[model samples]
Target chain A: MNKLRETLREAIVEAGVKDGMTISFHHHLRNGDYVLNMVLEEIAALGIHDLTVNASSIFDVHEPIIEHLKNKVVTGLEVNYMGGKVGRAITEGIMEKPVIFRSHGGRAGDMENGSSKVDVAFIAAPCADDMGNLSGKYGPSACGSMGYAFSDAMYADKVVAVTDHLEAYPLADVSIPEGYVDMVVCVDKIGEASRIVSGTTRITKDPVGLRIAYLAAQVVKHSGYLKDGFSFQTGAGGASLAVAKYVEEMMEKEHIQGSFCMGGITGYLVSMMKKGLFKTILDVQCFDMEAIESIRDNANHQEISATRYASPQAKSCAVDSLDVVILGATQVDLDFNVNVHTDSQGYIMGGSGGHCDTAAGSKLSIVVAPLIRARLPLIVDEVLCKSTPGETVDVIVTQRGIAVNPKRTELKELLVKAGLPVKEIKELKEIAEAITGVPQQVKPEGRVVAKVLYRDGVEIDTIKSVK
Target chain B: MKIVKNAVAGTLESSDIFIRVEPSEQLEIDIESVVKDQYYKAIYQAVDEVLKEFQVANGKFSINDRGALDCVIRARMETAVKRGGEC
Candidate 1:
């Protein structure tokens, strides 16, 4: 054990991670994680300099991380999504190394295949024994599943556990075994579970959101998809769930029925199964109580793992056979390129969790989003950061109008030919820029912060933070 | 986006994946399509089975095909109906 400890530190020193080695972080935190900032401060106290911080994903709570990047103490980054002020600084082209982004599975695959290796992994365990048996269930900051942390802990060269409540020796209910752990540190608290949930997972009650839900239903209806025994997947958000409700009513009215609902299983999704719309629910991860209960008791409600969820290598990945996927976007460009990466100003706070996979595999991938955000347009000339390429995105639904990929000129022509509210993308961009006033200049430093990875596991783009 | 609420009933159209509906009523749907090329057909068959089971008139319905297999379609549609009551 002593040798292992000494070897880890020695490896860090030998690997040229002296004061400014590029360090990496992973976001299983959603918004409640504090490990990144806390570890960075501790590293800084050790006199680390010129450090580049790379995380799987960054969130709004991580705004303070940008200050490290600007200080030259932290010099690089690699994350899935960029939002808020940090993204703006990067879009202005402030950083040099283009930020890199990747799909969630792709990131895991890369790390597994040794493409993206980490020097140290700072994982926050909700429940971990002193000897390093870690699970997210026991800790005060339990976030249910540690699905995101699996890769980091397994692949990182040096794995460190930061937790507040350490259990007895030989920790029970461990997701990350002690065999991979290098060190254990106890803190007063990891973070607040409420903060971890950041955005409300509830379905939307707003009239506009409800209106969009209705519109989305119409598109599905007119698309010639409405029928008994249909299969589909929507996000777990309010609008997505609300669409299920509206569609349920339609089923009753039409006397139509359906079969299965797949993907991230939530309570809402479970309700659908229980009501007999679907004969069963194929779930990978349960998002709430109803889902958990359903998984435990309902034979129709099943649980799946990440590999079965979208893994190309799986016998039959859930995504490969999707018919239609409804999604959300931060911005949709004219080329049909979608940006869930950075905001108008260029900060990253999101990740590509099967976004590209579903878009690429689904028969019809529909992105439902308002045309503008905070008075700024959601459609831009060029994405501040490209998470999902335009090629994969089929339909872009804005509050003002909807646009289809020109590649599907037939679909575009069909929609326009249908006389639906369709308009040229340029008109939408101009209207947005008109109100936002031609967005101010954003400067990015000449350093790569993150990388964008295609569903096929190819590097797409690299992002840099502004100086 | 739309005013009336008919699509959710699952009578609107059929696909392997999704079903359609409007928001006039609490947004509820019983999507039964599967992740298969014949997902629409599968959903159609599953709905027939559900109606036989529930004894409701084949009722108005909308579907959003997702390319699911027959078993998967039956599962989703049943789940959709079970939960459709809440919303």
Candidate 2:
């Protein structure tokens, strides 16, 4: 039986689109995604309101949701990461309800546990068959990995596959099997493939950022985690990419072969795997075009689901095997509480994508950031929003100095004895203040605008509306 | 001191504040900042201090702060106010 639908509106009606329902979308296409906006525009035109969108992440391209918010066509939002445009509006208290932010793994777990149920999941597939088998690796809009959509396809009451490329039934390869999909809709374009991997994947050239990266690599080398079979993860930030570069050099110099490098896999990590630095790349998501090509061709570059990446409820996830994870922060507190949820002025600009999960599961969670950004201290008395708890964090690396969490005293000693600049977290704060001048305490006056949830589905912090 | 002419100081760069002062019937201060939530009060306080020092009570002061420190904010406000009226 053919599952193909002629248009998105027909698929929406088939999926039973209505007001006040929790619908979901995956962000495997990232900033290039058009399905969410397209579907929402249709739903709004259908006069639907009070719909809660549980997207895997929200990007700058989804700014049309601002007008939807004003019209009360969409009222609730739940996401793992948020780009700056919608984030600024949310910070301004556009919605009466606070946005719910979950980690990548946390979102998967919640879906599996039925805590965050989806009435319908609209998946943007790169290629699919009439009978609904889908793959993200073989079409014009290919984004390489459909990892984030697996749970949505499996758990949602209705699963609609929107694709630009329609293959014949009984496809050769399938990322999502036909059994899980209910409907397939062929669209002119699913997304812009070029914009899927944005420009944030390059290595840093800023001297201060490079210095921090270098020091972070030194800490990883000296902390005894750089031995054989080490598994590592890092963000797609410029400085984090630079850390990978330095670490790759160190691994080659010492001839240490690692087990795996995981997370949003980048070309830098792909090169490391190619050079025999790591035996495999456990990529939950591909961050760049090089990574996409590598995963398409390389045997060792494997795609993993979000649950397999960092689910706390999973029997055992890849993050548990991680030796080190380098993350960036908007603001870090004296206690090492990392705030990736909001900026220095309490504006919603980011969220706990994998920050909490990796930090919680990795043997050493290292945060690297400049001491000051825009003349505002990076290290503060208290983070405006606690995205990752301090206890899970092991070290804080800045251009000026490094601070190991008091709980990681052994790691601290190891770095200090190895001639690294190891100092107290408070001291780092003082140094930052000395450079930027102690900033006045930011007072956010309105109601809470967002809730930062840990990997275990607990609310760690609430972000107040920017006054 | 009565305000003489509209004047502006500083540049719209990080760690700097651009302040402009002009004649007004009553004291008025407006501020826009990158770190607005955290430093707006402090920036307004700095401008008030500078205005009080100059004894200028009836001029409009507008500031665009790009995370400037209190000292830089004060300096820019002082300069702007000085150029606005008799030093």
The sequence of per-residue lDDT tens digits that candidate 1 reaches over residues A104-179 is: 5566666666777777777777777767777665567665456556667777777777777777877645667888
Using TM-score, give the best candidate's number. Answer: 2
Q: Ten-residue segment with the worst summed lDDT in candidate 1 chain B?
A: B1-10
For candidate 2, write residues A315-405 as lDDT tens digits.
9988898999999998888888899988877888989999999999999999999888777888888888999999999999999999999
Error of 2 at A42 (Å): 1.0
DockQ of 1: 0.01
What ranges in model 2 sit over 4 Å off? B1-13, B16-31, B40-63, B69-87
**TM-score for the B chain of model 2:** 0.92
Chain A accuracy of model 2 expressed as TM-score: 0.98
Off by over 4 Å in 1: A1-24, A50-52, A71-73, A88-96, A167-174, A177-184, A198-200, A222-231, A248-267, A273-308, A311-316, A345-353, A372-384, A406-451, A461-467, B1-87
TM of each candidate vs. truth = 0.67, 0.91
Q: By how many angstroms RMSD does model 2 differ from the true structure?
A: 3.1
